[model samples]
Structure formats: structure tokens, C-alpha cells
Target: MIYAILTEAQNKQEKQPDMADTVDSSIAVAGLKAAIRVASHGSFLRAAISMGVSQSQLSRRVAGLESRLGQKLFHRHGRGVALTDFGQRIMPRVQSLIAELEAFDALVSDTRAQLSGDVTVGVIPLVSRHLASSLVRRLQSTHPGIRLRMLEAYSGQVEEWLSSGRVDIGVFNRYGGARPVYADPLMRGQVSVIGTPDHPLFRQKDIPFNVLQAIPIAMPARPNSLTDHILGAAANHGISLNIALEAGTSSLIQEAMLASGLLTLSPAGTYVKAISNNQLTARHLCSPSVQQTTWIATSRQHPLTAASRAVEKFIKEILYTSTQ
Candidate 1:
């Protein structure tokens, strides 16, 4: 067996003129990148900083790469680093490989820019009523290749969806407060008392906050931010709200309002169609009026794709028009 092994070794040595000229098969692309960065910067420390790695880590990668190729790629010195003669000869090819990779990446990005993928959006009910159709029309007209998916819910649910990465974009309301740090302010609208058109409050342009104490009101249940804001404001103003019914949704509250002649609090955006159709009347609450700011936000958990960004732009345009 030892004689056979010796003969095989001799045959392999004879076949290859120089074993040191052969590169190992396991050379990593990262090692190649380190070499290029070190060569380009002309300093190991500078390259390491730019690469977000320690100087020692960069040096080891370069050394491992050099060992694999059986050649020294850099001349280390106190001043900096310099490419060896062999390194200078091969660097152009290495740079070419990187350039090709970058070109390929740009090609993939261009494909994405076509906006041909699904984008999910989470929106509050108030905004979604008008926004959904307008956004669909706009996206269909311009970004026809994109497929859109929408989730309609209240502000709390929408926020949860955004945080959990369930949606790429979020449009919701923040009541009676400064805009959230991470959100982009879209528009501000008055919170109004909504009821059937025949209601006596419709005679006036706006109603004072204290008047809610005498009227029967239907509102979204507690644990709602908007409901909390209304209740808190009522307490501050020494006005006890006559919360006759506590419904889970704005639609149910609207129905209760219509049937029972109970007024409900809502943003102007929520009842635009009903008001225009003369099915309902909305008078802004005043004398310490409640205001809600609409905001467009994206999740840190879910990075926006090209399609998602396109949809976001369309939504912003639609909502901005509502403000005007």
C-alpha cells in the first residue's frame, strides 16, 4: 500500500509542473473582496473600517486567501499596505468581477422598479373608505403591473399590523396629540358629531363639547384611542358623555346613531360620502374641539419594496387631495 501511495504521489507531481501555482477550490468571495478593498484603500486599517470589520479580521482573511493561492497579495508596513507584484497583476480581474456583480445587482433592481409584485397596506376605516377606491384607480392607471392587498381596521389594529410586519404601509389616525415620532403627518381633520340629517345639531355649523352631555351618543367601545380621547376631553371639561351604546366598529355606531337618533363621534373623512349624500350630517365638535391627524407610516420590521413604495405614493396623493 505504501509503494502504491508513493507511485501515485510521483505521478501527481509529474503531471503538475508547479503545485504552488494551483489555487485551492475553497477560496471565498469575501476574501477576494477584502483583498480588493485593502488594495483600493492602500491601508489595512482604512479598509477594515470601511468594511465594518476589525483590522485583524481583515488581515486574517487576506492571509487565508494568500495561502489558498500560494502567493502573498499585500506588503504590510507601518505606513500602510501595498499590493504585491502578483496582486497588481490580478487585481484588475478581481475588480472586473466586482463590477459585474454590481451590474447584475442593478439589473435586478431595475426589474423590481417595474413595480410588478404584491404590496400590502394597513389602513384605518376612516381613510380606507375613500382611499381604497382612489388608490386602486390610481395604481391601476399608472402602476398597472402591481398587485395590491389592503387590510382595513381601526387605528390600534393597523398599528399592530405595521409593527408585526403584517403590512408594508400603514395609514391611521392619531387623536388630539402631536404626531408620533416615526410617522409622517398627512393631514389634520376635525372630529365631528355625526347623526342623521334631521338632527337639530345640523342647524349649527359646529357644536360645543359640553353639548355632548345632554345628547345620547353611540361610540366605539373602550380600549380605543379615539374613544379614550373623547372620554378624557369630556372629563377635563366637566362634561359627562351620555355614551348610550358602545359598539366595536364605526359602521355599527353609525347604524345605532341612525336608528336610535344617537350621535356618534367621528373624523370628517369617515362620513364624507354619507354627508354628501344627505344621509348623515357632521358638525365639528368645538369649544375645545377634538382633532385627529392622519399619518402615513412604514414599519421598521418590514422594509418597503418597489411595489410597496409605489402604492404608498398613490395613497399619499389620494389622501392629500382629500385635505385640499
Candidate 2:
């Protein structure tokens, strides 16, 4: 009987190391996150800087992840790194998994009586300039527990963030068309020709679209939505634009206008402060007006937490009140 009992104890001891090995060999959440960050940035140094971690530490975490997966995730070169074929194939699934985990965490947090969590919002520069402070103040007064994080970017970047589940909400502009099925229209604003106060265009209440044919205009560079809109409008109206300057941002275009007497076509909201201060003047484009509709959108890929929903509500309220 003593021999039998000793044999059973020995068997249990043998299984302990196996269980320990299983736990140690499993992929860790931290490692997966590190790998994803590195993949997104295409460089370990950049990823580490973005994550507020040391390069060596981030490298080690990704190395461990690669070991567990038994695949080389990145091809290192002098310029940076690129994902291996396997990494490219698996990245989408990994991103989806991480998004699911975040959603689950938000779901668990929502069960508590008080709504509290981080809500990330992406918006175009125009929306950010106009509504960021108001949104922050409203959220602080109403839902103090809900932390608001804002990402100001162009419309295309905001759309990418929304699609990737990187942000809880997105505010962007849709020009000259029906609203996208996924987004809710918040407000509509006229796109106008803007120039310095001394410019000849603002001499009238509104400028005809054909007038732009003779005007030397400053515009955003090609591959931009606004640039595309203006080009398309010019094509439809059978007029040619004399593009005097091509800039990367609205501020640059405005600066060019001030220094060179160049005019730019943009939304009225974009230069509201400048217009009000008499630094710039806007003339509405008429006879086939160009309009931009601002949209509030969310990802269909992820579920919204209660905190996100609360922030969304507050955003809508602020927009509606501001429009009124």
C-alpha cells in the first residue's frame, strides 16, 4: 500500500512540469501588442517611441511572439523593416483579435453602474478646431468618468481609423454627393472661394463658379478630396483653373493667399476665425454651389461601449446646438 501511494505522488510530480511548460509557451498579450505596434510602424525604433518603451524591450517582446508562432515576422533592412509574407497574412486576424479583446473589456466595464472608460474619437481638422474644446468641456461636466481622447486628422485618415477599429467615432466631410450609408450627417456647409480682405472676389456677396477660370487660385495638392472636388466641378462647368500654388494644407493655402494674393476654394467653416478677424474673407460659390456635409461615423466592426455611446450623444448635442 505504501508503494502504491508513492507511485501516485510521483505521477503528480511528473505532470506539474508539463503544466508549467504549457503556461510558459502560450502566446502573451503583451507580446502580441508589441508585434502589432512594430508591424504598424515598420520600424522597431519608431514603434518603441510611439509605445513609450525602449527599443530593446519592444524587440524582445516581438521576438518572443515570433518564437511562439514559429515564424519570422519581419525582414530587417537598413531602412527599417517590412513584414514577412506570413506576418502580412496573419496581421489582419491579429488586429481583429485585439479589437475583439478591447470590445470585450469595454463590455465588462459597462456592467458597472457608473459609465467609465476611454473613448477615442477621430475628426478632421475643421471639426477639431471648432468642437474639440466644447466636447471636452461637455464631457467633463456631464460624464466625468468617461475620458475623451481626440485624434485630429484628414478625412481619409479618420476613415481608416474608423475602419480599423482604432477610434470609437469619426467626424469627417463628405463633399458633393449622397451621404455614405454608414455615416450620419451632422451639418452641411458651403464651400467658398477664400482670399485676403483686400481681394477683388469678396467685393460681391457671392462669386460665380465660372469666375474661377480667370482667377489664379491656391489649392491643396492633388490626391486630396477637396482638390478632386474642385477639379470635378471645373470639369462639369467647362472652365479651367489657373492653379497659382499647390499646398499640402489649408493653412499653407491661406498663407499663400495672404502673401501672393492667391485665392483658394474651401469650406466656410475652415476659415471662420480668420474671416471673423478680417484676416481672410470668404465668397460663397454660386450657380452650381459646392457643399460639404459633415458626418459622424462609427465602425461596423466593433461594438460601442456605454462610454462611447455617451460621448457620441454629447457630440451630437454640441453639433446641433452650434449649428442652431
lDDT of 2 at 320: 82
For model 2, residues 215-252, the per-residue Cα lDDT tens digits are: 89987777667778888888988989898888766778
| Weakest lDDT window of 10 consecutive positions for candidate 1 | 1-10
Give the Cα-based TM-score of candidate 2 against the true structure. 0.63
Error of 1 at 227 (Å): 0.6
Residues 1-324, model 1: lDDT tens digits: 212322333344335534432233223456778899899889988888766679999988888878767888989788898988999988888777656654554456656456688888998888886888898888888879898889887887888888898999998888987556457788887899899989887898889998778688887777677888899889999998888898877788777877878898888667677778888888889999988988998876855776776787788888888779
Residue 141's C-alpha lDDT in candidate 1? 87
Model 1's lDDT to the true fold? Answer: 0.78
- Give the distance in Å from residue 224's predicted Cα in candidate 2 to where it truly belongs: 2.6
